[model samples]
Target: MNMREKTTKAENTPADKVEIAVRLDSELLEQIQHLTNDPSKVIEVAIRQWLRGEILRDDELTRTPVRTPVPPRGEWND
Candidate 1:
């Protein structure tokens, strides 16, 4: 199997966590490298904050109605 196939198979594994690749700008990566040795943790935390609506773009902050929040899994009784 080639590299792509290997990556796809690994990503599909039934595990609590799976590895995936992301591309980042070289300058941004360098900045992250300077801040922490565990960049993955930083990225994960940023994603979680975004999901919780703690982070938003300037345009999004001014948008009408705003985005509706998703209810937690157990609350979807309808």
Candidate 2:
């Protein structure tokens, strides 16, 4: 089997999902491994949650009104 086949054979992965490697600190990897046998699931969930928050923040920023600076009180100069 080729590299793609090996990576894409992860359990519970969708057919459309393809694997891409990511580098993580050994300490972080150990912690993740302790939490669950399937690190991919944890990473995927974390990414989804982060993306959702980012999207909401973007939407709020787009909807927020832009503040216009008020001109200093003075006689109008032609």
Candidate 3:
């Protein structure tokens, strides 16, 4: 059993949160390391990307209300 196999089995065990694996080749891993060495950050970015695509596919992320642009200081005079 390799490191990944162990991780997969461990993730399968019942827990409060389920886990998913993202397999990267050596070259890809090196590229990611150039940007960040934090594994949690990398996982978070991947998950966010997945959710973005899912929401877009379902048309659920559309029509976010735009916030009113803030005026320059003294321009608002509020």
User: Evaluated with lDDT, which candidate comes out highest?
Assistant: 1
Candidate 1 residues 1-78, lDDT tens each? 776655665576669766779999999888988989978778888899999989868887787985889998888976
Query: Which of 1 and 2 is the better model by TM-score?
Result: 2
Model 3, 1-78: lDDT tens digits are: 776556554466568555567787889888878888865477677778897874345445566778999888888755
Q: Is candidate 1 or candidate 2 better by lDDT?
A: 1
Clashing pairs in 1: none
By lDDT: ranked, best first: 1, 2, 3
Q: How many backbone collisions does model 2 have?
A: 0
Q: Order the candidates by TM-score, highest first — what do you get?
A: 2, 1, 3
Poorest lDDT segment (10 consecutive residues) of candidate 2: 3-12
lDDT of each: 0.82, 0.79, 0.70
Candidate 2 runs further than 4 Å off: 1-13, 54-78
Clash pairs, model 2 backbone: none
Question: Roughly what TM-score does model 2 have, to 2 decimal places?
Answer: 0.52
